[model samples]
Target: MKKYLPLLLVVALVLTIPGLNLDQVSAESVDDLNKQIKDLEKEQLELKEKQDGLESEKSETEKKIQENLNKQGTVKGEIESIDQQLDTTRANIQAKENEIAETNKEIDSLNNKIKELKEQIEELKEEIKKLQEKIEKREELLKDRLRTIQKNGGQMRYIEVLLGSSSFADFISRTAAVNIMMDQDKAIMETLKEDRITVETKKTEVEDNKTEVEDKKVEVEDKKVALESQKQELVALQGQLNNQMAEKETLMAELEHEHEELHEIELTLAEEQEVIRAEAEAKKKAIAMAERKKTELAQLNKKEPAANSGNPNGIFTHPAKARISSHFGMRYHPIFHENRLHAGVDFATSTGTPLLAPADGVVSKVGVVGGFGNAIFISHYINGQSYTTVSAHLSSMSVSPGQEVSEGQVIGATGNTGNSTGPHLHFEVHIGGYGNPVNPLPYLK
Candidate 1:
């Protein structure tokens, strides 16, 4: 304002009338200045309202930004947990598959062993059959010998043959030949009996071995079946993990969309703040012109006095009777377990607890606004400067836009909506302009 004052003074001098008395000129100047001051005051009111709206918007956006940051942290942690579980599930499935492969190989080996045992048993059966046949043939020959001895008077047959031979050498030859024949028959019978016993013992051993291999095959098959079931369970777990990851990703997308909205609001708020500053400067210049004209009029009259206007700036009061739940600025979030800006101070309260307006103001906004849930924005002028108040995370609001509200008026109700961990009232104050928040503790008292 001071930067443009010299120029304004120079312009005033150039516009002074040349052929009139100072009193006449002063009256004209005062009337024109009065009109200008009225226009500037009207414009000032509009600018102040705009400034409050933008400040409210910026505060809300910052709250949303903080909420998204906390949400992102939570979603990312869930995703990481799902990833870890997926790794474990996959490893378990691989192990089961490996076990199944080895079991199949063992089953194959058992089948081969069983087949070999069966072949060995068949060979032993063939040996036992041949031994039985040879024993039967030898028994048939011995039966014929016994029949001949009985027909020839049993023991006397050999003696009669010796007597009928009429020669000692012929008798002795017959005796030796008979003795050799009987001894050879006895040896053949003993050999056949021993071979049959040996073949039967070998068949028993082979049969036992076959039974053992078959049992092993059955056991291994059972193990494979159990392993398959385990693999299926692991696969099911993998499916559950995939679903969790998808849900987390969807939540992250929503948070990102919210962050984008906040970015747009921030940009718009910055531009509006600049506009408000320019309008304030214009209002300042208009006030200066009004003062200049009043001075001139007073000098001409020499019998005037000016009255001081009372300041309309109001004081702030507590909006609720709750304790501070969360403070403004950076802190570790409880749910997300990560550091993030809190943006607004949270007042601990039960759900549906009514909130009050801190000062006389006009409600600028009343609706659901992202993480703030049901919210209210109020515009106020304090000490000739613009400020905005934001109340968030409400279950219900009782006010509407452009509605006049007095100090301690019920505006909304507190709640645990959006990204909150519990029921609370989120309150913020943006003084002068927008963007960074100042500590609202002094005002909340």
Candidate 2:
């Protein structure tokens, strides 16, 4: 924030100054004016100090803003990196899902094969059961044949049948019958043995098929479990990546907000510095004006003889033979970009144009005067009124302070010097004192 110390000083200085009695002169008033001028100079020094402080503050704030920008840039890079991680995680998750799906398909296939194998085992069981039944029936028939042979005498019965036959032809028929009986018993035993072997083979095949299907199913199930675990891991990775992205984004937002705040502070500090600098300049000018007034008043008390007494109306002649380019008033300043007091009338002319004294008066000031460059001040006492004329922005000066100069006398040549835009004569008329400015056009002859 800008302090208005300079403004307060202006008010205090104005109040301290007593109204001048134009006809009388006093030494006490001049002393009081001198003390006020000293106070203004002191205040101007303080304003400059304050301006320096503001400049330092502004510089620090700008540094902080730059640091914040750097942090934001780093955060942006982190966020981009997180985005890439998220992309990779998402892709991995999709791949895991596909693998799980393939595992599930494999499991389904194994299950189908197990079911078919079970059906095949069941059919084999049925066949083994039928073969066992046939073997049991054949064993029963062999046992009956053995009982019949034991009941009747084995060889004697056969011999009796052969003896009862009437001829050899009858005996041969009995022998053929016995041979056919033996062959039938042998065939039954062989069939029972073959049925037992076939049952064992079918049972073994059923057990092997069941074991193979179960093994395949277990392998497929294990694969599914692994795929599911991997998928879960990928999902977790994706979540972590998302969290990182969100955190980076949040940090970036905070950094951006901080940058904005610091930037605003820097701008405010700069504005305050500008205000302080401008106030300091005003204070400096005030001191100079007060000093000039004090000198003029002191000179009046000495009762110095009038430098010239030719003009009756106390009007001034033109300071330069040129047209008025700018009039005295409040107007927009081209360099400062603000509405400020022009303070003087400007005469358009080329470099080295002769500048003349506007009135017959004593040269009160002749030197470089800050922004005014090589300047001249002439104090005029006419018709019981005090006036001071100022001619500034000179390329060369020919007059000296306290020298008596006549109206229309060449005191200097104008040029584009010290705060001027071009080579021209800047003329000002101050009434009663140095601070009280008035339009010189009205007083010009």
Candidate 3:
């Protein structure tokens, strides 16, 4: 009973909320509202009971759906999924409808029971009242008899009546008269006692029945509230399911478009990598051709690659002002839960945070390439080693392909775009080509 307090309070609040005017309620109106509420509650309870039965039906329906999926072709599987949803929804609605009927019948039964109990209680009360009155009358009569007997010397009167006989015939008649009076008083006294017990017994029985009825009424009211809430929820869910079926084609088209878009992005990335390979080949050819005139070029230009800065391994700096939220490794993804290589370290940064260039390099590609929303790929040939740094999931980019950038320069902004969960830099360092990746954390200053 104590556990029911919260539920009751919730019901009260829900019914009274949203600008309901308490002052507008008259006694009659309150009574009417109470009657309606009780009816709704009862209806709700019945629907809920029906819902329980529907759960079993739902389970069975789901099993049927699984069977369809297991045996059907791809196209049929989709159609079956929708059909299953419709079947489940229809089953739920039917259950609630049946519940409504059952509830109404049960409510009628409860009302009839309550009426009978009230009538029985009233009859008992009337009987008790009558018995009380009878007992009172009997009590008074008995007291009067006692008083009369007392005035005439009580037990002595009986003896006197028997002894004070004029003749033998008179003695016998007086003795009979005394005996009849005593017996009549004793019978009335006994009747009074019995009536008192009868009144008390009826009163006790009525109290017990009244208490039982009150408890039952409370139980019915609570069940009604819960059922009403459940029914409304189901109604709303049914509407949503109907809408899904109506817009099935639109949803299917959207999904197809997404897949096509992904394929295009992959093709674009492949094309860009091809362009890089072609450019690298061209450079290598030019260097080979220049080798023939190496002595003459050395005499003209006595310059080698720039030396490492005063700072230790000063080839790079942090790409953004952030801590490493995720480390690069073969691990399960947070969202997909698939074990895949996390190509780069994820620097947890706010959206719009500037992504600083870790080293002087030429930007190779910058565009909406794929899942890496707005990406920037930079290529560097330092100390005869070809290295590429790929920064992905950018909110915005400041550099373009073929653009040159120095260390600490802003190339892009961090973002939660492209297959990303939140705003963070997905930075990767690749050796040789984009295919080879090593941890970026080892290079960050």
In order, the Cα lDDT scores of the candidates are 0.69, 0.71, 0.66
- Mark the 10 consecutive residues where model 2 has the least summed lDDT: 304-313
Ranking 1 against 3 by lDDT, winner: 1
Worst 10 residues of 1 by lDDT: 305-314
Clash count (model 1, backbone only): 0
* Per-prediction TM-score to the true structure, in the order listed: 0.51, 0.49, 0.42
- How do the residues 1-445 of candidate 2 rate in per-residue lDDT, one tens digit apiece? 1355544554455553466343333466445545555554665566567677777887887888888888888889888888888888888888888888888888888888888888888888787778778888999998988887777876576677777888888878977887777888888998888888878887887798789889888888888888888888988888888888888887887777667556656654654454344434333343434433555544443543334332334367778888889999998644235797878899997889988877566766676665676778776654334567888889999987657666678888998886677788899997744546898877876
Which candidate order results from sorting by TM-score in descending order?
A: 1, 2, 3
Model 1 ranges off by over 4 Å? 1-44, 122-128, 145-172, 275-445
Give the winner by lDDT: 2
Q: After superposition on all CA atoms, how large is the RMSD of candidate 2?
A: 18.4
Best by TM-score: 1
On lDDT, the stronger of 2 and 3 is 2
